[model samples]
Target: MMPAKYYLFTDGSVNPQSKVGFGAFLLISDLAISLPEAKKLVETVSFENTSSSKLELQTLLWVLAKLDAVATEVIVYTDSQNIIGLPGRRIRFEKNNYISKNGKQIANAQLYQEFYKLTDRIQCSFVKIKGHKRSLDKDGIDRFFTLVDRASRNALRNS
Candidate 1:
């Protein structure tokens, strides 16, 4: 059976001080026709990390874990091309033990491995969006992304 589909907008940032924060909003509808309509959850996590990419992956893991695999058909909207590219790189990463051709361990290898396992357990996909767009120029859906963008960066500042 096809899983119920959901849309998730996510963003993460890392400050110079190595504080990282991730923001994500989950919606039951494909499009956020109204900011409040069918919006399920807004999640934020903050911690000390040097890599925005790692924080991005961790934020995703946190959200999907909260859903507990019930909402498996999630369309993840994010500005991170690395997250968007994870699936395509999976085969190579797995084949090489998440090591680079130079025999060096890849950055965020553990998180990527966990994500690879999660993809096997459930279903999800990625959609890359432009980041840091001016608020006034955004439409219905993008406004929510702006929300996430702020929330994530706010975490960095507040913590």
Candidate 2:
């Protein structure tokens, strides 16, 4: 029997007027899910004085927390290089306690710490997806990613 499939596509954008970052993610169990269906699964949040990286991490933590009690795995798709690069930087982050050589905390160190802990406690992986692209594929990966990207950028458009 095949295990249930889990896929999460995420994106984050900062509001220029308020510097409030908005992040959105869509989690689903079916690869054939449509954009309208995926929209129902999308979640959004805003954080004041936040960067895109922090927003990305926060959204990740949000989805991580949404998982059931059994510590199920998830495959995350995102446009953020920061999220795509975490695995390569985990060693340095752990070695230096999430600090830089300048004796200061790395940007979003706290969020990264929490994300690291949660990730270690669960099984997860990351997939890099193109953002704001005008291309579509037969697999629908691009469709879901495009939906998430728009959601993050438009979440607080009126504010």
Candidate 3:
């Protein structure tokens, strides 16, 4: 019998500039090994004029819900450094009024709340990757995020 395949998903986002932005990745081990490589989950997102941390948290919530629906274990990764720094960073949303204490919370609190609710459903880990330190594949993550950010901007303009 073959082991389950794990999933490693990476995601990122951009703010409206001069504001906070976030980027993160997820890893799901103990999955059906016959599934596929872990990289297929990699993706990036973009939100205008939003906090990076919020964006990062939003991405986390999205992935977690998806994972729960599929019943998978995951370990998320991110280059945000700050978000992955402390534990339950997003959980602290209640303290900062759904945003970090230092910045404005995202406009869509309900979305974050819906996703945050899933924290209890699965086991997950948040890891920090040093930026510009050549310590955690920062370049690759940055490039992926940048591409997504630009694409998002273009999409908004077109719409």
Candidate 4:
């Protein structure tokens, strides 16, 4: 028998200093994925990195790791379009430098590269949302993301 269909709500935030964080609230109702399974999948991914942007991307990738080979549909919501846009375009990271087709060096190559890899897995679509919105759903997501964001920033600052 088929497992089940699941909808994933994900959000990420990053400070200018390159600190990044990602949070995912999986909706595991009868129409969504199983919470226990999803949580287990998320636990398998590590968040040790130099930047929060990478953390955010890692969170999304973590979601992919949880899916059990069942054809589950995932919808990811994020506030960081700059990072999410990496895979949508023709971009590459070489020698820790983000290089364009013209060999122009882009900033945050590591984050982009990780996001690039995260974007390669599973059936997922990213939607950019306005951060700190007053809506309840958006606000709750913001709270979690803020924690991840601050944690990332503090870690980077201390390092």
Candidate 5:
């Protein structure tokens, strides 16, 4: 039997005018089972006075932290390029002492550090997905993206 593949779709919504944000995630599994038989996980978190980028990165990190050790292979989809770019930028940040071009400490330094630490424990990959649009994939993975997007936005509205 083949191992099950785990897919996580995450999104973050922010209202700059109100300084409110929310992060959401949907987890799906590929198994030879009926739709009802497959477990679906959906969750959201709300925060105030945070940037959308921070919410995005936080959602990704949150999901990673929630993943079980048995989940050997997992893929995470997010609309945030900042979150996707972290792995490549992490090395440079460490070499530069986490300093930015303006000599300020890199933004979200603690979150990025936690994200990196989680990556060391789980064999996972991060993929960038376009937001506020329907997905073109026939496999229906895009549905999860849409789910998280709506959930995050709703959380922002209610928070």
Candidate 6:
């Protein structure tokens, strides 16, 4: 039998000092009638060499890992289009297969590989939502993209 579907909203924030924080809210499809009904999750980390894109990718990987252990089918909502588009693009795959002239691995290759592995273990899809936006759902619940965004930033600040 197929497992139930879940929805996850994720966001990541990075400061100028390379401190990174990620936030995600998960809800079983049946309970996702409002933003307040979702559960909040957050974490913080730091990278010596970091970019917002890297933080975003890490955030996706982190949330997916958590979801994989619980749900068989998950639809992830994120603001980072790059994460959503990675699997559909060929350039990154090709780069990961070949080493650069300087003999270094392609940036984010490991994360992409981990993402692929996790995706294989569970049925998952990604949706791109606009960052820092406030909108109302059909059920009149305020969409929590802005909430997740603030949560991530708060995680960074508190860390």
Best by lDDT: 2
Q: Rank the candidates by TM-score, best first.
A: 2, 1, 5, 6, 4, 3
Instruction: Tell me the TM-score of model 6.
Output: 0.74
Write candidate 6's Cα lDDT for 1-159 as tens digits: 434687666677777665444544444465445555443433344444557778787777776776777778887777888788877854657654835567786678788788788888878888777664435432222254555666767766776
Looking at model 4, report the run of 10 residues with the lowest lDDT sum.
41-50
TM-scores for all candidates? 0.84, 0.88, 0.51, 0.51, 0.83, 0.74
Q: Residue-wise lDDT of candidate 5 within 13-102, one digit each (tens)?
A: 999998788888877665343333332456888767789898888877777776755566678888888978888987898898788899
Off by over 4 Å in 3: 1-11, 18-41, 85-112, 135-159
Q: What is the alpha-carbon lDDT of model 3 when measured against the actual structure?
A: 0.51
By TM-score, the best candidate is 2
Report the C-alpha lDDT of model 3 over 14-111, residue by residue, as the tens digit: 54554544444534454342223433443544454566566766666756666676644555556555446444555566677776556877566666
> For model 2, what is the C-alpha lDDT against the true structure?
0.80
Native-vs-model 4 lDDT? 0.50
Pairs with steric clashes in candidate 5: none
Error of 1 at 10 (Å): 0.8
Model 2 deviation from native, Cα RMSD in Å: 2.5
- Per-candidate clashes, comma-separated: 0, 0, 15, 4, 0, 0
> Who is ahead in lDDT, 2 or 5?
2
- Residue 34 lDDT in candidate 2: 69
lDDT by residue for model 2 (75-98), tens: 899888998898789899999988
lDDT of 1 by residue, 1-159 (tens): 434777778888777564555455554545735666533356677646547777788888877776654765778888888899999999899899888988999988988888887777657888888886777887666777877887776766776
The lDDT per prediction is: 0.74, 0.80, 0.51, 0.50, 0.76, 0.65
